[model samples]
Target: MKSIIFIETTKSGSSREAIKTADRLGFYTVLFTERPNFMAKREEFPDVHFMKLCDLSDMNVLQKEVKALILKGIEVSAIVSYVDPHSYTACTLADHFNLNHFSTEGMKNIQNKIQSRELLKNSSVTPEYWTVVTKAECKELEPKIKNKFPLVMKSPKSTGSKDVYKVGNLIEYRKRYNTLSTLYENQPILIEEYLPEPQYLVEVVVHKGKVHIMAIIKQDIQYNRRFIVMGYKLLLNPGVRFSNGLMKAIKEIVAKHGLETGPCHLELRRKGNQWKLIEINARISGAGMNNMIKAAYGINLVEEMLKMALGNDPDLTPKFQKNVYMQYVTVEKKGTLEKVTGKRKALASQGVVEVYVKPRKGSVITPPLSMGHRYAYVTAVGNTAIEAEANAKKAAAEIQFWIKESPKEKITTVIQ
Candidate 1:
């Protein structure tokens, strides 16, 4: 039996997908994470093991620990991780074990958003309307600059939609900038032109210099300027199509930066007839975007990564599903206790595949819905794209958010 190691195997959809892939590959997969306690929470799966690694940034210590694990009779063949910070650790471990892996340079280029953007610019694949801002110097920036308004401000190092802001004017830009700068303190932010078309994300699984599209997902956010993503659905939209030119640009950028192998999630924006490159991710994205893409496309990217790590080529074919949509339930306001209506009835709706609800009736909710803050999520599939999207929306609408209005927004007392 082959043994594979996954770094940062926390309790996430990615972790669940890894387990599924391990089962499919029939390998003894060991997962290393910061939270060893996560092992106690999950139900048992045969041939799956969980280990813990502390402080992914501590390279030397991690090396010594891996050596110790090897000495302790753990037969490890390949190293893989679904998280950004852990990609470097995976590369290091793979090199130490002499397993087929992406080079250290590749990992760095993809993981560092700044480096990735620079590479894109050098290859002429990036758009012309993007600017990087350091926290200190950002105060001097004119948010209403004639050049780059109606823009997106994003954290270079963030994963998912943690601190992204869409600013229309100078006031909004400065307000959001100060809020983020005060919270994060000196981290770099990217301000780029906000493209008007639907946002499309492509998941690429690169093995031995060959790249395959694992999935294509279209994202939906709560509002235009909100950083938090409301949900994402599989891309079956007619408008969503990749061209040969864009593919060549991506390959050139990846090759130039040495992003030779691994799972990458690249975001692209379409303006009129031209496709512009957004930032690329070194690792898999949050939500089950990759899995949905695999289920739709029949290209098992996780399984391919596993095979690549084991020095094998993946079998690829065009496996495409008809239509699918995934959505998240977000609260409208903050309150102590609330009631969710029509949950059981919604679950029985046609084409509803799965539903995950985190908050009970009385759970506290936060604004700008994030990865773990979502009260619930729904994934649906159907014969038509519109049907699938409607099913997800219907299911989400059933879950009511009965929140009490905050004192600041209250107008009743003032009028009285």
Candidate 2:
């Protein structure tokens, strides 16, 4: 049987779904991961043919592992990863094996914010940005951007909304810069002009330089300490004129950056009458995106991406189309999760299709500092966007998290 290798996977979401898809397609599936806890639960992944523990950060270690598999007569068909820097690692390994996948340069362009922004600096889609490596550089650039308050500061490699900060003034800018510099240590920080509300996520599939706009999701974001995506609504029909303009922009961006094949998701914001590029990722979006897309369009994106990795043309035709909405469950305070109640009720609610809750009992939970803080989600469908959204929210409200506040300890001093 032909084999496919997965470099690392998210605890939940598209990555895990891809592995299951590959197994169902009858390919020998092998997983290399650093999480022993995940590997220990072998019974959970019965479809996986092999699971090996390895230092995923070391390419030499991965090379040796693949060589051992080859010695055992495993015919490797494709190497895939949904997370980065493992995504970049997978592309490099595909090149080493002469397999079909995205170019490492293209992946890097998508992975590195600074590189992508610099490459598309002259384009209309490019947002105004400045790169800083130190507090001195931030100070030097501050005067130039004095009037541009409410800018965003972030590490080039940050993901999942971590290490991204929105500052309203010079004091906030310097404070955020110090925090990021301390976290990254000599890595360049990108400060970009903050785009206002009405952002959209474009899920794209490109094959042999042809771009396919599979789904356009309108995002509902809540601004707290970080940008928290509270919900998503898939636009079943985004109109021909709007779709055409978005397609034209996406095509130009993909061609200019050389992302000739594979799956990519772009985050764009509406500025006046035009859409501006926020960032691009070289993988299908995580966090129930696959589920949302499948519910809305009846297209399995993860399966399609797996097929593409194995040098097969994907079937992108929509089997059906409907309005779908997803709402995330989050807490407003920090405490220990004692229990989660109402899953059955939420699942049984009208129009609710899926209800998933993460975080085991006694796990610490906090408000949205990043996407990880979201512990549960409810997906629902309707004949209209408002109906879908209302149904999702109604179901989400049925589920509740019971958390216990941590007790404060009193300190005692002894005098001798």
Candidate 3:
């Protein structure tokens, strides 16, 4: 029997999708994770066997475990992971076991923003960028590169826009770097020219030197001093011209960057007539966006990626298409969630497929300043963009947030 292995699996919806897909395919799914109790918490997954690991970052430990398994006469057919920092580890293990996967070198190209830029240098998608180690280094190189203000600084190894900042001036830039310096210590930070709006993302899966283009996601991002991805909306009513242009741009960017094997998420910005690549990573889109993909196009990327990892050709063709949107739930205030009303109303509305609110009645909640702080997301579909968008918004707004505000500093009146 064929066996599939997933490393560093978190107790997330995406992780569930991957393991369940493997189980459905009749593959014996073995999951390695730091949280072994996650298995006991889950009632499903009768076929999934959970294994505990001491450290996910230590490749030596992981290598030893897999090697031991191999010596036991167990044949590991495929290896896969959905997380970012762990992607390279997955590739490394796959290479060691001679399993099918995107190469470790290619993983390096996209894992770091600076390295990804280096790989795409001299291409039409190339954007201005710089790397700095300390505050002094950033100050020294700030005025030297392109003389562009309002640049964006980001962590080279970051995921979900954590430690990412936008600086309007030199002072702000220096300050942001100084704050991040203490956290990152010696790691280099990537600073790049801020691309304007009309940002987009494309999901592509590559296998055996072949690139299969999936959906083209139109992003609605909120940028203050940082970027908070508000939504990934469907592309409805895109004329023939726009469709051809988007497809061409996506194809060119992936081919130029040499993205081969596994599923990759590509982001780009379209300014007037020109399209500039933002960044690309070898992973599935997160934040429940994968669910939206399934609802919109009847394509389960998690399932497809597993098949790809096993050297099987999964269907890339869209089974059907609909207007679908992933709308994030952001709190307006910080407090314990007293109550949430409007699920029946939201679900009762047209085009609303799913409404997932994060905060429980007694759980503490805060405004979504970054991806980590996002409260919940709702997925909706319709025949048109307006319908789907309206449905999602209506559903999200219907769920009222009644937070019992945290108590302020109390003063004693004994003096009177």
Candidate 4:
């Protein structure tokens, strides 16, 4: 039987769903992960035929294990990963096995923000950006960009809004620069012009150099210390002309980067009638994106991506159309979760199709520092975008978290 090898996957969401999808499609599922104990205990992945524990960060170990699997007569059909950190590794392994996959170089470019910005520097999509690699470079570049306040600083390896910051002035720039530089010492730091609100997520699938637009979802972002995407609303009827323009730009980006096949999602913002690209990932959007897409259009993006990885034609045709909204639930303060309430209420609310909460009674929780901080979400469908968003918000509001706040630090005075 043909087998599919999956790299490290998250505890939930589309990555985990992909494993289940492959099993349902009659493929022998093999998982390579570092956290076998965590995954082995989960009843969600009972169909996973084999689970191998190894250090995923080391490519040599992964290659050796794959070779061992082949020696054991495991028919490795395709190697794939849904997580960001291991995407390039999975693509490289796919090439070694002569499997159908995206360009490894393209995947690397997608993984590294600096390289991606350099590749698209001349394009109309990217923002004005600068890179700093050393302390001297940081100091030298500061004077040049001092006037360019409200710039966004990012570590090249940052993902999911982590290590990404918006600095409003020279002081804030210095502070954020110090923090990120210290955290990612010796790595290049990306500083770009901050793109304001009304962000959009464009999901694209490319097959043998042909680009297909799957969906365009408008994002509703909320700001605390970091920019948090509070909700996503699928645009069922984004004007034909507008979509055409987006498609053209996306095609250009894909062609320029040599991304001939597989899935990629682009984060974009409309600036004065022109769409500017924020970032692009060589994978589908994470979290409840697959669920939202399936709920709205009756298409399983994860399954489609898995089919593409296995050298099969993906069906992007929509079975139905409906406005869908996904609202993320977040906390306001740092604390130990004491109790959660109203999940039943949220699930029973009108138009709510799904409600998911992550934290348990004893789980520690905090305010949004990144996308990972979002503890729960509510997905709803309606006749229109407004109604969909309203329903999701109403349902999400019904779910509440009760927590025991962390104790404040005490200040001590030293007499001289």
The predictions' CA RMSDs to the true structure, in order, are: 5.2, 5.8, 5.6, 5.3
Cα lDDT, model 1, residue 84: 62
| Candidate 1 vs candidate 2, lDDT winner | 2
True lDDT of residue 305, candidate 3:
83
Total backbone clashes of candidate 3, pairs 3 or more residues apart or in separate chains: 0
- Give the alpha carbon lDDT tens digit for every residue of 1-416 in model 4: 68999998877788888988999999999989888665658566687888888898888888899889889988999999999878888999888779856678878778777778888899888888998888788889978898888898988788888878889988888888889989988888899988885899998888888998888999887766888788898999999888988887898888767788878899998777677889899888878889899999899999999988888888999999999999988877778887888899999998998888888888888878998889999999988898988899888888778877633421111111
Say which prediction, candidate 1 or candidate 4, comes out ahead on lDDT. 4
lDDT of 2 at 385: 91
Ranked by TM-score, the better of candidates 1 and 2 is 2
> What are the clashing pairs of model 3?
none
| Per-model CA lDDT versus the true structure | 0.67, 0.86, 0.73, 0.85
Worst 10 residues of 3 by lDDT: 407-416
Q: What is the per-residue lDDT of model 1 for residues 334-394, given as tens digits with 9 covering 90 to 100?
A: 5653555566866788788766665666667765434555666777787877788888777
Candidate 2 residue pairs in backbone clash: none
For model 4 the local lDDT of residue 95 reads: 89
Better of 1 and 3 by TM-score: 3
Question: Residue by residue across 154-200, what tens digits does model 3's lDDT show?
Answer: 78777777788888787888788888887889989888888776888
Candidate 3 TM-score to native: 0.89
Error of 2 at 87 (Å): 1.6
Tens-place lDDT per residue, model 2, 137-212, is 9889988888998899999888888888999999999999889999999999999999986889999999878899
lDDT score of residue 352 within candidate 4: 93
